[model samples]
Target: MYKVFFRICRYPHVVIGLVNITTGEKGYWWFSILHEEMLCEEYHVKNLKGVLLDELPQNGGWFDYNDINRI
Candidate 1:
């Protein structure tokens, strides 16, 4: 068995929830999830609670090779 940890964020820098899994591989960051979902708005990306931005409405897209596309 392995220990695994997971976290959910309303936005990139915003961390909302975290959990531990009883079994899993060594901990690793999942930076590839951006493309997996068409949009992160469901997770409150637009209205991220804990995340703060230099500008209001924070009209920025998820990180990526380009880091410009909203989805």
Candidate 2:
């Protein structure tokens, strides 16, 4: 299983980036917050670099798990 990390954007309902914890692969494409919410509820996507959904940082580029603590 891969842990997912994300950063929020200026838009309140969008995610700007996604990072795969183990592989360090990043997805720069934007994602809908609603979709991710569904993913969390249905698929049990729990790991967001140990941060809560409402606590994700905003206005930054893609980042990996290592950057979570620094952010």
Candidate 3:
């Protein structure tokens, strides 16, 4: 039951760098890098550092991946 929350310092999307902000694990760091690069070329307002998607909202909303693709 892992959950992620964002401080939302000054950005819309939270950027979870290579390091897992919670457990400090290693993986999906590329996601952060890619996001930064995107912001640079697209938004040009890179200042993201929030919660990762896989680590966010444990079904807090109406949709949860746990069963989405399972049918």
Q: In every candidate, how many clashes are there?
A: 0, 0, 2
On residues 1-71, what C-alpha lDDT tens digit does candidate 3 reach at each position? 12222222213223232345567544321223444455445434444343234433222223222333332
Ranking by TM-score: 2, 3, 1
CA lDDT, every model vs. true structure: 0.30, 0.45, 0.34
TM-score of each: 0.20, 0.38, 0.22
Q: Between prediction 2 and prediction 3, which has the larger TM-score?
A: 2
Model 3 stretches with alpha carbons more than 4 Å out = 1-17, 28-36, 41-71
The 10-residue segment of model 2 with minimum total lDDT is 50-59
The window of 10 residues in a row where model 1 has the poorest summed lDDT is 15-24
Candidate 2 lDDT, 1-71, residue by residue in tens:
33345445434344445445555656643445665556567556643433323422333344344443333
Better candidate by TM-score, 1 or 3: 3
Instruction: Give the candidates in order of lDDT, highest first.
Output: 2, 3, 1
State the lDDT of candidate 1 residue by residue for 1-71, as single tens digits: 21212334334433222122332223222233342132245444643323322221233322332322342
What is the overall TM-score of model 3 with all chains considered together? 0.22
lDDT of 3: 0.34
| Residue 12's lDDT in candidate 2 | 37
Best by TM-score: 2
